[model samples]
Every structure is written in structure tokens, then in C-alpha cells.
Target: MRDLHNRISSPSAARRVTGILAAALLCATALAVPVTAAAATTTGTSDDATPQLANGLALTPPMGFNNWNSTNCRAEFNETMVEGIADIFVNKGLKAAGYQYVNLDDCWALPQRDSDGKLVPDPVRFPHGIKAVAAYVHAKGLKLGIYTSAGTKTCNDAGFPGALGHEYSDAQQFADWGVDYLKYDNCNNQGVDAVQRYTTMRDALAAASKSTGRPIVYSICEWGSNSPWTWASDVGNLWRTTGDISDNWSSMLSIFKQNAPLAPYAGPGHWNDPDMLEVGNGGMTDTEYRSHFSLWSIMAAPLLIGSDLRSATQATYDIIGNRDVIAVDQDSLGKQGTVVSSVDGRWVISKELADGSRAVVLFNETGRPQHIATTASAVGLPGRSAYKLRDLWQHKNYNTAGAVSATVPAHGTVLYRVSADRHWASYPPAVEAGVSEAPLVEAGTPVPLTTTVTNLGRTPAISGSVALGGPQGWRVKATSPTRTAALSTGRKLTTSWTVTAPAGTASGAYDLTLTAAYRSPTGDAARSELATIAYVVVPPPDGTSYVSDLTWMSATNGWGPVEKDTSVGESAAGDGHPITIGGTVYAKGLGAHALSTIEYYAGARCDTFSAQVGVDDEKGANGTVAFQVWADDALVASTGVLTNAEPAQALTADLTRAKTFRLVVTDGGDGGDSDHADWADAKITCAA
Candidate 1:
């Protein structure tokens, strides 16, 4: 569904400072909504009454690929892409790992229906027609899914025909074309009741299935606005419990917090979907992607791949293709995980498996390493003296004396499959090790790095040693005692090292590895490794310079890649036009959408930052946004609310002795529909 239209702001200039202060207060506290035990499990719902679809499909949450998040409505979302995905699923290990469906999202149909009241596939996109594409997918032993809305038109701005009044005909058409799945969206519904609208399609699909003997999996994509999870259990196989998902930690974490509480609503045939997967998207790090996948699996959500599989990396495949994690999602118990305990930002979630076992996750949401600990009894397990722990990511087995703990990295998750089998003497020690965040430093500067190792096993780890390794041409020396005495169970050893990069090292992110080695009580050697990143920044320029000319330490956008000197376009890089604000084009600036942040290395040399900011004209009179400038973590300046109806407004901030400078743009209390923002004539003045 699209966002509501913008509300105009007061033209009073005095409200600018007040708005800035208010927004700063909101930014400081709004995003820290905590997950608690009170909302962990569902109440008032009897387990015996959980609704199920009689169709018998989706006995477990469906695992498959959807081409919406990566190539939504783009030219590349054609017959070739769909067939290629099926090929990859067959050739790669995905098919063997239980991923079956190959789905296509919106814009697959022509803008207008045929004269005979039938839908037509876009000839340019599917030259061979829909039936031929379905045949190709079926030949590869995979099912095919198609997308449409229940309204008069689809969600995309192109206004493709929907299945509103034509449900029976459209259902028959899809069944005749061999379509195995249908993702029905909610858009432009013209104020109709949600239950009535979805039920109409449900009956239509059932009738079509009875006539044609072909069952199509129904996915209700009402975006949780109507609380689909509470009633759509019999109407659809899976229903989205949240809005669309972006490829960022904040977005993923927010969705997880929203979906994790609805555990009781998910079952074998009906599920609570949280949009789609964004594993291979470049917006977040690999560690964060792993956490995303783990949380989704523990929730028993649908495992739909949302990336371009033809161009994905090995790391993406490794995270999504983990059969161990997939098994947890497909467990016969059909139970979603609930939060066992949550303190500060560390969360412990556990799900009961069908085989008298538990799937536990130690999730860290903070920006630093944390020691998250739980117990077998707390996670709803049998009170065994010892348990067999299998690390899902590491794919290793260990023994623990009822303690389920780990030093989880920032935005990382430690998943374990715990069984009550007591094989403690045969397994090695379970040591959870991680390093702290490396400080941002200039080239040739020495910085201290720390690593902490903890023993969570039944026996002690003997002769433990920790080492930190840096990139090539860098020097690493231990600053503290590297060797430790016998670390008893639940004990920790912290070590530090001083590292210096070469003088000529370029400014960018560099990789670092922290290794911890120890021996079990039986004198068996074991090693644990954690990978981290360090930043090397260049000094600020000596004179006034355009901000778009300097290198930024980090940049994150809402829709697509941050443009250098153009407006924020769709998902592709460099697809934007010139930086235009209210029809006035600027020569140099940074262009980004709302919910964006760009960080620069001010290096304490920058004094003044100034820019003319407004909603970009590329989106016409359709956007509303606000801009803010931060020196270090303090808000130095802000634009109250600039809309596409208004001209550019000047903004300046004092950056005295501030090491980091941040540029932020947010949707002005509305949603981020067309909020294309620009920092026109953005410049930084520094001391020479």
C-alpha cells in the first residue's frame, strides 16, 4: 500500500529550532523499543483450535525464491530471470535443501486486460507467454507463483489490472495456466472489508481447484494492516504480518520485534509471514544477514530468497542454504520460537522441536560484543545434567552442562540445537570468543584492540591464548598477557593488542581476524575465530570542498545506493537524474532518500558545514522530508520540514573539534513513499 499524502508545515521560521530539538529527542529514544517477556507468548488462544487450511499444501512454511526485493518491476524481471532462478535452484544445493517454488512479483501482467476480460502477460517481459514459463519451471521440478492485487489495480505505479471483480475468471485462468501459487496483495481496495475481500478469492481458488484438480498456494499480502494473522489462517497459506522489508538492520530488527510475539498464530498450513528475505542485498554486513536468517527461521516464517541468485555471493548462499537452520523452520512441530529471556539488548529465544529437542538463539542487538547467557531449564528443556549442543553456523558439536551462553558479536546470532543426550566426555569444550569494535583511526596511528574468550562447557579450557591479526603491512603486538591460566567453566579471559596501519594505507574498511586457541581437559586442541572490520580515514581537506567530492566512511540509504550528484533513484546505482530541488538543478551535492545516513571523517579539522536542502524535484510535488546535520553525536542543525512544494532552505552546522560528521534525512512524520532529498551546494569549510 502507498503512503498517505503529505501535510504542509507552518512557514514560521521560529519553528525550525524547536522542530530540530524535538526531532533530536525523538531520534535518541524512539528506536529503542525493547522486547519483553510479557509479550513473548500468545494468550487467549487454545492450541487445539489453531486454524489450518484443508488444502494440505504448505504443511511447513514454503521455501522458495521471489523476484520482488531484488528486481521489482524492473526490466530484468522477465522470463529469462525466472528460468535462470529455476536453473540455479536445480544446479545449486537449494533444491536439495528443500527450496521448491520460483515466484514472480508484480508488473508481470500488461497494463490493461484483454478485450475478453482476461489478463495478458506483458509480451516484452514474457515473450513466450505465462503457460510456457510455467512449463519451463515445472520441467525443473519447481512450482511457479504469480502476483496480483485484490483491488482494481496492482501496487506498482504502472496501474496493472488486478483480480477484484474478476476473481472467478482470474482464478480459472491461473489454474488453466498451471500456476501453483498466488500472492494476492491489498491495494486500492476502495474501502472494502478485508475479510470479505480475501474470502472472495479463497472461494474462487477453491472452486477452481475443484474443477481443474490443481491447488494454488494462496499468500495474502495485506501487509498486516488488517491484522491478517488473527483471521487469515484458513483463507491463505501464509499472510504477511508486517509492511515491506528493507535491507537494513533497523528495518529487519523492527520487523523481528513485531513478528516474534505472534508465535501462537503460526502453524503447519497457515503462517505469519514477515515480508521476504534480503540476504544478498549490499545494504548490511554478512554478520547482520546471518542474524536475519536465523531469526526468521526461528519464527517459522516462509524462507523466500529475495536476491538476484544469478549474481549472489558465496556468503549469501552459505547463510540461506544452511540445511540445519532450514530444518528448524520445517520441523514437524510447527511451533514458532518465543523469547525465553530478554535483558537490555541481549535476547534468548527457544523453539521446541518435534524430537524432544530445542532450537535456541542467543541474539545480540547492541553495537558491541555481549555475553548472553541462558540455561537449559529456562529454555523449556528437560533437566538433564548435560546437553549436546550443535552450533548451526559453525556446524560443530560440543557439550554443555546446562549453560547455553556465548559472547555474541554486535548484530550477530549464536544458534544451537540442544538435545538432552549426555555425551559430555566425548565432546570438546565450548568456548565463545569475540573481539570489540576497532576504533576509527588515521593511517600510521596505533590503536588498541580487545578480545574476550569465555568457557561455557562442562570442563575447563586449559592453556588458553588469544591472538589478533591485522591486514598486510600492518603491525600487531600484544599489549596484555596473551596466555591465560586454566579457564574454568563460566570464566572469561580478556586480551588486548596494539595495531598500526601502514602510512600509505588508503582510506576504506579493512578486515581483521581474532583467533582464540585452547585445549580441552583431555588435551585436545581447539580454535575459534571471529572476523571484524576496521576503518582507515583520510584527513579533512585544507580548504572549502564539496561534500560529494570527499570519501565517506559509511553510507546507508532507504531505497537504493546513495547518489553522488544526482537525485535518489530506484534500486539501481547511477540511475538518477541531476540534483534538482523545486525545478532548480544544482551542480554538486549528495542525493539520498529518507531514512538515510552518510558519515564522513571530519577529523576535527572541519569548522563549518552548510547546504541548501529540500525535497528533490525529481519526485514532483509528492514528497515531504527533513534534513539534519550532526557533529559527532550531537545535532548541530536541522531543517524543520521541506516539501516539494517549497523552495530550497539553507542549513549550517558548527563542527568545532568534531571527529565525525553525519548527514541524516528522514520522512517528516509521514511514510517514505517519494521522499527524494538532496543536499544542494553542500560544502565543508575547514581550518588550513
Candidate 2:
């Protein structure tokens, strides 16, 4: 078997350079890519001739648990762990909420096959063999899924036997052992055709099902290398549309971008798989995880849990077990969501539901709060005067007069179930409110903030008033009229406020609330509240200071936590080594992976920012990345592309009066593989 760590690259520096140049062009244009309303033809395949499977299974994308992202080939990935997960599923409401399979990933079999050419379960790992484990899971009312490769050997360094030429026998063994699902991987195939290999296993599974009177769901894990979406619908119930997913925002975002465009290829029995769920893997925040779940559900992908349930948190369970969100994935319509609009990191996706409703997702991919708005007609909903909207995450319902909008948090998603209703006027007017201003403020300085209240309900809003409040010691006062006599449907009332942070305030994020109080024309009172963050910052003292030593307003990384004065490591804080770029070690700097950003509250006091940027030497010659420096929203400096094969390049940005400073690293267009980047010897000089 081939070592997974030594996987193939793009083959030449020229190709990498082209990828980098393309990425640079994208960055110059707000990272814009052409948005398609329907699935476009994939390379080398025709979707029109793609067949559909009649397996009578996975009519909806499978909802299950796979122990790969959380455990991989660790010692704890044994029978006990699998059974414990089944137990959690039953006892913790996951099974009740629709999770069924308790799946095993790689490393479940012995190193060699038995004398009769049969695979053997590792004695120490599955003491009672796989059949007993399957029985245990079945006893708990859940099914079991097993893993194997289509090649001569399975992935992983242990090199267990695969079902290359023995697909019939292996399928028979799995069916006899009561397996209900098979995750067919694509490693060590010796260059076999992806479709041919997968179809062989599909046939073998069908034969085994006929003989054993049991159905098995086939998942083709070819990692989308061969444009499986164009042809795999006939071969497997679900097919992976992208490479393996790391538990990070960048990986998830990239996979979503790849899968969302293939919406037209997915349906009742054949689904596009964007790998598995990483909801509770600990590499992302609760907000980001929610976005991941929402996006997956809207895409109509399989809902496979990829966390260790034995030690999972309540938040994790809550996210995975959200029946409302899960229903969108398992909708009887089975139509995948299409991108309604995507511009400057704001995405609006809409999926048609079975009950004459549409599931809408307002996703903010940027690094700050942004107001995303759309309309019922924009998302293919029938023209109506009013619509009923249910907020999936908040579990609240509101009435909208054709306008769908929200101030989504950074890296957050707002999901809604929108249905046209003639009786929407009976509900209270939906007055949406939000505040906008430069979030960063110098201590004791007043900043102008604008609060907008829009009446989106069918009825008119009467006596509408808006107010802004901050911390106890801070000052906030409205500068414009805060009340309106009558605001018609779709009309907005804008109010201005001057907010001042207390002098000597410590630098950090502070909470602020914007409240809009109104009454319907029928005399019913209604209120809407929005919470936002404001950063109070103090400039660094006179002289030069290491950037890593200063406080950052926000930090988002591609893989693992950002490191202070170190090289980026894998998925853990402070696990990195000394900051090293092209074999040179630096004692002071920030270590981050690609698709990362670190923002500082410069407070308009910094004069200059400089750093030596490159792919970290810790990745050897296997990483490619680009470095960018931004002053507020303007790009001040950039290094087009840097690979581990090149030496560090110097970057400097003028920050004479910039209030905020940002350091950004992006993947070099190919993908974020081993994109560990270093900002070595980073420094900022500010006046006292």
C-alpha cells in the first residue's frame, strides 16, 4: 500500500506557479468566482447519460456515525468504542433523531488474510469478531458499516488485504456478518478506473444481498478524483465529491465550494458526499460548526457524525441532533440546494422542500458581521405578499413580507424554512435591526454608529423606536430620531448613535445590543434584538514590539490554533516548534496555516509593519502558500506565492493611520495541503 503521507502533488513548479497567479487574481477581485445556478458539466463526463441506482436504500442521504475524524487508526478505535457509540446513539437521542449506523473506518482487520482467503478481525481489537459486534449494534436498533479499499490493499500503513479481485467473497462475508453499509475507499488501486472498480463492488454487493436477503448501502470514497459526480450516481448510493476533510474552516469551505456546484447531480437515491461531518472535532468553534452542519444539510449530503461520542459535549450533540436541520437533509423532495447568489463571501443557498417550502441559508464567510439579504422570488418561491420564516438554529418563527435578511455573524450561518402563507398578517410585524460601524475604537474616542430597523412583515409597523446600549461605563446616545409614526412594509428607519468607550479601558471585545420596539397596526406589540461586538483597543507603547507579543482582536486559522512565536502545528495550541521559514529559525513571529487571518486593533497609532513570510520548513518541500497584509479593508502588501523550496520573502506595509492591521495567508489555488505558513521576525512600531 502507498503511504498516505507521501501522496502525489501537482508534479511541477510551473503548475504551482500558475495556481498561485490565479489565486492572486482572485484575491484582487474579492475572491470572486463565477456562480452557477445549476450544476455544470464535469470534466470528461456527461451528466445527461448518468444512471441512477435502484437499490431501494438511502432514499435520503444516510444519517450515521463514522469513527474516522475523531479516532482514525488510534488504539481506542476498537469494538468497545464502536459499541459505546451505539449506546450513546440510543441513550442520548441521536438514534431517536435519525442517526442509524455505527460505522468502523480503517484498521479494523488483521495484517494478513486467513488461510481460506478470508479477512480476519484483529483479535485484540474485536475480541468477539465483527459478527458479534454487528449483533451488539443491531441489538441497540442501529446498523453497522464497515470499511475497505477497492485496491489490492487498504489504506493505512498496516496494509490489510483489500477487495480488489475478491469483491464477491468479501461482499458475501460482509453480508453474512450482518453489515448494512460499506465505505469503499480508493487507495492502492494500481491505477484502475474509478468507475469500473466501484461498479464491480456495487455488483458484488447486489449479488451478496440477493443471496443473504440483506441490503447494503454502498459509499464510494473515491475523493472526487475522477469527477465521480458525473457517473457514480449509478454505482454507489453516495460518492465523495472532494478530498479528505480536515477539521478546519478552510477544508470545509473548500469542500462546500466543490460540492455546492454539483447540486443538479444529486437526488433521492444518489447523493453527492462532501466527505463526513466534523461538527465536534474540536478544530472549530461552535459558530463554525453550526455553519458546517447547516451547509451540509442544505446540500442534501449524508449526515455522518465524525466525533468521539463517548466524550462529546452537549453542544456537539445539540448540533448533530437538531431535528429541524436534519429534516432539511432528509427531505422527501431530495432536491439539493442551489446557490441563489454568492458575492464577496456572502452566500445565499435555497433548497426546495416537499411541503411547498424552501430552506434558505444565509452564510457569512468573511471575518466580521455582515448583513445578508434576499427575497422569496430570488430563491424560486412563488410570488406571495407574505411568508412564514422559521429560524432553524434559534428555533423561532417570524413573518416576512417577501424579504429574507439577517446580520449573520462572522463564519456563521442563518438557516430558515420559508413558506408562503396568506394568513401571515396575523403574526407580529418582523422588524429586523442591526448596527453598523467600525468595530475597533480607540479608548475614550467616540465613533458614529448607524442602526437600521427594517419592517419586513406584511403589516405596517407603528410607533417604531430603536435604542442602542453598551457596557455600564460606556456612553451611548442616539443622534437621530429614534421613533417613527408609521413604517410601511419593506420600509426601513435608520437611526444614528454616538458611542464612546471609557478611557483606560482594557483592549478586548465588548458586547453591544441594538433593540427595536414596535407595534403592529392592529395594536400588537413586537420587539427585535441584535447583539454585536465592539473592540476597545490601546496602542502599543513607544518603540518596536513583536507582533506575536501584542494582543490580537481576532484570529482564524486553517488548521489548528494560531501559535505565538512558533511554527504552525496540527490541530493543537502551542504544539508548534520555533518559527522556521526555509530552514531559518526565528525567535519572534506568528505561526499560522493557509486560509488564515490575524487581526490587530492598531488604533491608528502604528507607523509600519514588517515580516519575513514563507511556507514553514517544518513541512519540508511539500507546502505552497501566499502571504498578504491589509490595512483595514485595503490590501497594502502581498507576496504572490511562496513554496517550501524557496527562501523567505520580506513583506512590509505602511500603517501610518490604519486603525486595524491584518495578516492573511491563503492556499496557492491547488488546495490547502501542508500549507503551514510563518510570519517570521514580525514587528510593529507605534508612537507612545
Candidate 3:
């Protein structure tokens, strides 16, 4: 990969001088071999230079497996595991997919150094030593990566030698052991300046590479404390932009948000590292992993796999081996993708490819499918030009003359490679729309239904009208029906209609239609319509089966995430936000009690109160917490000391028949350690 960046310099100084003279003599011939985007954007060149210096090995973001997310705190970092992983890479086809390094994150070293102050591999774990391990890995056609800290002690009690005072010796030893990559971490720095400390090791690694004729990919893992992207590129190949990522969606998305904006700092060898990949980890769904991969690719982030390869599933292979997607990350442009347009939980990102094509992604992060549409102009492509739209993942090709629209499923993505060509003569006028309305509506109430229609077409819509149609008995009135009908390209018009459900409408899901019509120069009219905007109609309250809409709560808030459970299994994310505590997998109520609360109204037609509460973090030590149920100003029921390992505890209160109730979660003075509280199956029963 490094050779791909530039022609190798001749070994002799005289030969290099000759090449320089030749390049000067034939400037046009020298320009024939184009400079790669990655090579030009070396960390400090213009954008994201790390505070620490980088070694410039990860010109494209590094791709490989790290052992952290899989083994966590208790890994027996050994020669056997690394060699076995090398075998799995070949047998599992990961080697063909470009995963090279088999990295040892931590705990691979003995707690104490040798008599000569040299780092030692754990005798029990690696009896044959790291050199032998590296040889085995290299023999299997894979590179070996090692980990250490910049301080005297590592973050964990791995007893690993910090590369502070022993930078030269450590680098020499790593080179001798055939270590191809080094993840220099930040822990126990003891007030030493991080920049100075990391640069010391970076220089040591360079010297070692020079002395040993071995190039090691240096990674600055200081947790982005010193803003490595601002300076690290000159010294290292990649730098950590954020802290670690949990095997969950929220944490993953948060990390991307932190890293994407630093795209400019990343090019060629210098990349903004967002930690490792948890693609095969069990904490998230397959859809979530897909989104995770998509975001990382566009961000030009490293694709380090952080799970056990020996037992990986097929879904994991599909995501990690996505060739088309990987090509985007490894694109010679070395461009990191940023969120260009975002609204209503939908995000669109575009990256300019080296081949003059544009890589675009329509991402849906919400809990349901989102209707996302964008024009070529919106994505920074030539709007008047026709392009070949290839769905990279779906393997489908389409001839789109206007805005590209897709119904991306929750946590799913639509990745397209748009390559321009002069094939079609005329462009169609496109009407793109977005509808915003309440998800639930009660009979006899009015709700705002707003739709924004845009002329995304390159051509103008000379005469047209945008309309909102609904059920026969519903009352609907639009503010500006045809205001944007005769607009030019890129023009937008908004129409808002107040809709009142019929007094006797049944409780079920109904569709609201939004249609936009345009007249062509030939006097022919064309229409684009969103036929179904799903809105649930709450039925008339009967003697039973009445549910108080949780969204109607006057106030609801929580620490961490106050997730609205659109479906069950929200608690499975292990974020302590959702958990099942009763017979039903109830997910709509409070989960995990980090000083969280959900206050709701019972209204005039209220009856009994019931909820099943429990703790969800079974892996951690149980903490003492209280889940108290309140009816207005009175205490109704309470579950005392909801321990982490405890089963579902029931709380049924006779509602004083108050018009309101609140679920208050409190840390029982233990400071909320492992207090994963869940108010599963909570309900306000209202009957005649």
C-alpha cells in the first residue's frame, strides 16, 4: 500500500538525485503518474494533522481485527490465538477481502519486564514468544500488530511496558519480533506532555523501521485527548478521534458524529480513527452493522474488525467482505465523508471518488423505514447530466432522470455509485416531497399535516399543483396548494393542512396521500405522489382495551437515553435503556434507572395501575436502587432495591384513581452502579 502512494526511491543517493533531475526535466512525464488524494493529504498537509506525529502507513484507513471488543478485559493474548486468527482469515475468505493485520490489543505482555528491562510475552499464553507468533502470522500471509501505552503503565493491569523511557528498546524489540503495526495508547501518562511523549515513540518507530528495514503502521491511540488530527499525521499513519465504541448503535453513531467532521484531517496515511469495528459483535442487529460499515466507509475511517474471527457468522462476513463498500473506503481520493444533508432521522452523505464518480449513501437511523429523496444537485453531482446509478449492495442498476429516492429501512442504507456519462438528451422534472405529521391521532381531534414539495428536476415545472388528499369524512385544508407549482428547479413550496379525524373513525392505521403534478411543454401533465403516510387512528374508548398514549405524557425524561420504544426488544441493546421485566416483552416504559423519570397523566377515564420492574445488567454486580410509583402527590407502589440479578418484581397500585401518575427511578445511594432498572409492562388501565 505504501508503494502504491509513490514510486520507490532507488537505494543509492545518486539514483534518487538522477530521478529528481529527470522529474525536473520532464515535468509532464512526471505528472503522468498522478498524485493520489491520500498521498497529498498527509495528516499535516492541510486538514487533520494529529497533535502527535504519525508514521504514515495507513494511507487508506487500516483494515484488520483487534481483540478488544471480543475479549475485553480478560483476554489471554497469546501466540496461539494470533496464529489461529491468521488461519481463519484464509479459510474464511477475509484475507481476500483485505483484512491484513492480526492485532493484539492488550494483556499480551507479562506484568513485569525482563531482567534487562525488555517487554516479555506472557509465558503461559505465548511460551514460544512474539517473534514466533509473528512468523506464523506472516507465514499465513497476514501482518502482526502489537499494542502498548505512552505512559509507565497501561490502562489495564496488563503489566505491559509503557514506551516512555524505553522507546528505543521497545521499537527495536518490536522490529526484531516482526511486528508490522503498533497501537501506541495513552494511559498512566503521569502529567507528561502527550505530544512530546507520543512523538518520542513515533520517532523511535521510524528509526526502528529504518534500522530494521521493516515498516510498521503506527497508530496514535491517545483517545483524541490532544486532538491528534490537528498534528498527528506528520508522525503516525492514523490517530484515534474519540474514545472506545460499545457494541451498540447509539455509541457507534455518536463516535461517527465525532469523527466525520474531521474528514479534512484524514488523507492517505493520516486517518481519523474512530476506534475498532464491532461488526460481528452480538450487541447490535445485522441492519445496525450494515449502517456501521456504511458510515465508516464514507468517513474514510479504518475498518479494523474487533470481534473473534473463529466463530464469526455469515452476516458478519457479508458486511466485512462488502467489496464495493470497501472500495469506497479505500478510494484513492482518501476523502472522508461528512453528513451533507440530514433531517427527520435521515442522513445523506457523498464522497468524491478518484474516478470522478460520487459515492452516496441514504441512511435511515430511526426505528422504521424512511422515505428519503435527493437530487443529483443536492449530492453535488451534475444535475443536468445523466449518470449510471448502480446500487452497490443490491447489485441493481437504474436509469434515473431526476431525484433518487429510496425507502431505507431502519438502521439500513442505500449506497449508490453515480458515474456520469453523456447518454440521455432530456431530463425529467422531478417533484420530491417530505410529509410531517403526528404518528398517532385520536378521533375528534385536529392534527397538523405538513408537506414540503421541491422541484428537484433540472427542468422547470411551468404549471403544476401540490395537493393533500385524505379519507372522505376527514376535514383537511391546505395553506398554499399551488404556490410552488410554477417554480424553477431547486425551488420549494410548503403546504400545511389541519386534519381532523372523523368522530367515529375506527382504531387502525390509515394512509394520507401527498401528490404533486407538473405540466410539460408539450401540454402533458405528470404527477408524483406519496400515497401512504401512515397515521394511527385511536379508536373510540370502549368499556375496556383503552391505552393511555405514552406520548401524551406531560413530561418524560431520563439519563443516558429516554428511548421511545416503537417496538419491543429495545432493551436488548444492553445500554441499560430498555429491558424486559415481565410476562410480556414490554418496552414502552422506563428501562435502566440512572435517575430517569416518565411522568404521565391518567385523565378522567383511568382505573388501575400496574408495572413489572427489574434490573437488566446481569453481567455486573447488582446495585441497590428503588423504582417508586407515584399517583399525583401520593405514593402508590414501590419496588425496593431492584438488584441487578433479581427477577421481575411486580408493582400494582390501586390508582387513587388520580388523573396523573409518575414513575420515578432513584439510585439507592450506591451511585447508580449497575442499576439497570426496567419498568416493563407499565400501563394505566382505563375502562368505563
Q: Write the per-residue lDDT of candidate 1 for residues 446-519, one digit (tens) a residue.
A: 88777788887888888999888888889888878888878887788988888788998999878788888998
The TM-score leader among the candidates is 2
For 302-343, candidate 2 gives per-residue lDDT tens digits of 999998888899999999999999999999999999888888
TM-score head-to-head 1 vs 3, winner: 1
Clash pairs detected, candidate 2:
none
The reply for model 1, stretches above 4 Å from the true place, is 1-53, 69-84, 107-116, 120-136, 156-159, 246-264, 281-285, 339-349, 362-386, 401-411, 541-549, 564-567, 570-589, 602-671, 677-688
Each prediction's RMSD over C-alphas, in Å, is 6.2, 4.0, 14.3
Residue 192 error for model 2, in Å? 2.5
How many backbone collisions does model 3 have?
Answer: 26
Instruction: Give per-residue lDDT, candidate 2, residue 37.
Output: 36
Q: Looking at model 1, how many pairs of residues clash?
A: 0
TM-score of each: 0.82, 0.90, 0.63
lDDT of each: 0.82, 0.84, 0.67
| Candidate 3 lDDT score relative to the true structure | 0.67
Candidate 1 overall Cα lDDT vs. reference? Answer: 0.82
